[model samples]
Target: MESIDRRLVHALQIDGRAPFAKIAGVLGISEHTAARRYQRLKERGIRVRGALNRFRLGHHAWTLRLRCTPDAGPALAQALARRDDTFWVHLMSGGTEISCLQQVKNPDELLLDRLPRRLVDVSAHNVLRGFASPGTWRGLACLEPDEVAALRPEFEPEPPTELTPLDEALLGTLEVDGRAGYADLAATTRTSESTARRRVEHLRRTGVLELRLDADPSRFGFATQARLWMRVEPRSLAAVGVTLATHSEVYFAAATTGPANLVASVTCRSGGDLYRYLTERIGSLDGVRETETAPVLRTLKRVALSEGEAFPCHA
Candidate 1:
């Protein structure tokens, strides 16, 4: 990708709905160049979509790791990917391990029991908190502070509201196309255009929905990505988590139930960068007892929403 393309992606990461003209103005480029670059990136399978903030909507988010026999790994991973509850499925540790993210309102005891017996081991971690997400990470550090500031969306905290069926329908549509037109949303939900607009706005105000730009970090120069699991002393869990959250490389970090009390996903420019992060940054943190790292080989799914052409490569 060209430098301008990286900048464009960064700007969109800040505000997925920012107009091409606005982006061009911020990047000091012609509107045509900005639009053309975005079109090219989209053609290459890069996408920006709206994602639901399930935690904000009073849902619990959990990351499940399944270890299967080599013969059963791929099929089992695909099965989990097909489920409505699993949003992300990844093949790790040479395809014998699968990691996925799922969200639920009330913990269902039968949920795990229903899994196919083909799996050998299964572990689930509730994502108690997040330090960074795609929506928050500024990739490649390409955009200027002023440009980023100009593109940032003004978020007005809305009081929590109940999500009606109509609200779910609207969220589902937006999850596919964060920039979907109100007419399209209205048509999908069988509601008036004005009602569709009002409902979407309400969801956003209430923090039930979020629009995010999903792209391949490798395409923009960050070629290595890894998931980190760390065990921190109980007294320092909060402090360690807060500190980890402040790092730019940390994408999603949360407290979980497993032996490893904390899990984090990080993207870096190369193997050397990853080493520095582990040895210098993470190694410096006090109270962190143990750490394990897994390189993500393939990402079958991206967000907590249903599967679709929401990402560029997967789409």
Candidate 2:
């Protein structure tokens, strides 16, 4: 069994709608205990919310990569941090290049399309066909120095095993359309409504699926977007990564191979807001060595798992 906190997080991850009483029964604890633990978890930044389906919400998505001047790394990072489409941002060794997750309504709005007119001496690589993580895979990475602090290590929870084919299809549909109804899913999967509902519950119970509404950021007033890349001292990565992940503007964070050792996706309401986040929040983090930024053009897809494919291909 998962630790109390992890168990609660896992329960919420599977189905944010699960009542405290149900979780209490599963963990053999009082409902009050479950509620108190949940409150504490949220205070510590352990979010247990539903995932969003960007496509269903009517927005375009894409990823963008950039090559920058080493001297401009910090400035570029600050610039990208201020946009809504920019989901993550980072600065690499000496700040020569940056990459980020970007989204736009149509091809014409791509930041890359306007880069030549806006910024000089920069190169880009745009991934037209790729997916993002369908679930929240990023958590604080453990560091050696962190062992000194009283940091409570959060164990990675176990993923559910053995989903039925019907379960898989229902999950696949919801991955793209979180609001899909039980009756509609039942019709598509050729099952009774009650059966479909049961399978959904099972999938949710076993941590195999999540069903929730995710809206496009633009619709909510966040308009600017970009991808930022950063290079930090290897020893300081854990602290730096955790700091970036906690930012309200940051949507995604992960370690990657490159001079810019870390990557992040950030969204903002305006260019001014993006700039303020980078200079005030990101630049203020300790152990950060340098950074880079790349504004995104258009997002083709945001990591929909319906394709059932794994990333970082292996032979």
Candidate number with greatest lDDT: 1
Residue-level lDDT tens digits of model 1 in 163-275: 79999898788877777888999999999999998888777676667676666677767888888899999999988887876787876677788789888778899999999
- Give the whole-model CA lDDT for all candidates, comma-separated: 0.76, 0.53
| Worst 10-residue lDDT window, candidate 1 | 306-315
Instruction: List the candidate 1 regions with Cα displacement exceeding 4 Å.
Output: 304-315
Error of 1 at 269 (Å): 3.0
Candidate 2: tens digits of C-alpha lDDT, residues 1-315? 135665555455444445677667766789999889866654553433322223222345444565665565566666665653554344543465555555455646768754533333453333222212313322222223332122222334444556568876776666554435678889988889999888766655443343422323453356776677778898987677667655657655555555666666677889899899889888888877787766554332333321111111111
Against the true structure, candidate 2 has what lDDT?
0.53
The total of clashing pairs for model 2 equals: 38
By TM-score, how accurate is candidate 2?
A: 0.49
